[model samples]
Target: MWQWRIVGNGGYTKIQNVASGTFLDLFTGTSMPGIQVQGWARSASESQDWFLRRVSRSDVEIREILARDTHNAANFQGFRQDLLYLVLPKSVRDAIYVKSGLKNMKDRGQLFDSDDYAFFLKVEVAKWGVNTLLADDFGILWGVMFGQKGNHGLAYNFYLNENLDNIMFFDPYTGDEKVDMEYKAYLAVY
Candidate 1:
């Protein structure tokens, strides 16, 4: 039976078994993977904390949910509107799109397919530098790479408070080895 649901993001999570009010715990609080696991009371112990190693294309459904529902509205409430304010004119949008590599694109889905998708967003974000203050907005942008290891899915970082340290742990696609380290470092520099 499907009885477990993950609470919290890929960074630090607690898998709760709905059938019982217990969380999935690492047996004896072992730090390595493939260790024995069991259900235990919610004690906020280190054993109960888990990190999602990857997000793949097959997890698009999960990604979409996190994107749409988990994002902190306070951080992004006016971001799109503000972006529009700067690039709403047809000419401006077209130019920014072309610079951001959105020209000839039929849908947003293609955005997920591009290797330079973040760079595209960066172009757009760069355009607003003079008009908008986006220091806090960078976190959400960094999250865009959340599941990129699985090969560019529709998921863009909607989960909040994501950072380099936590994101590096997620493989997202294979849930195996960590990927996109260079890109993450690049963004950190950007």
Candidate 2:
């Protein structure tokens, strides 16, 4: 799975779904002041739509000018050819696999385990320049969920610690916390 961060001018209020090419309105189209924006699908506008801005082989940023979907709501989900344009830094990728505890014996390695729900998250204390420990932790949590293993509730709790409070919240639908508490839990078990 790939994710993107979109930035635009003015106050666009939606994150465009690259696959469907439809814009998803963020904040229910209220456009509150000082709120972060995100990406969504909107049938009638491109004001907040964006194109890719390559930062490196593993890092590309999205540029646009809308307020919608600019914040937590703009995060891209699943795999999509169009959305792949947002490249992640090689270091970030490496950190993901490492933190997930997936042995990278060879230069080429698999990103996830068989269940596809769990991953080894690498936390490089030295690589804190461009990456944050919290960010890597969230990546591991999300990767597991995307792979369909960790409970949604657990993932949400970990996400909140990673600063994802804007998108999800505590709810009855939350799943087992034991699996989603943190990647450290898995390490302790092993």
- Among all windows of ten consecutive residues in candidate 2, which has the lowest summed lDDT? 58-67
Residue-wise C-alpha lDDT for candidate 2, range 1-190, written one tens digit per residue: 5334343534443454555554544344455676555545544555354354333211111111111222222332422122212223445544544554435332232343322222223122224423543433112222222212245222222121122212112111222223223321121100
lDDT over C-alpha atoms for residue 143 of model 1: 31
After superposition on all C-alphas, the RMSD of every candidate to the true structure, in Å, is 17.8, 18.0
Identify the candidate with maximal TM-score. 1
- Overall lDDT per candidate, in order of appearance: 0.42, 0.30
How many angstroms is residue 183 displaced in model 1 relative to the true structure, after the best TM-score fit?
A: 24
TM-score versus the correct structure, for each prediction: 0.30, 0.21
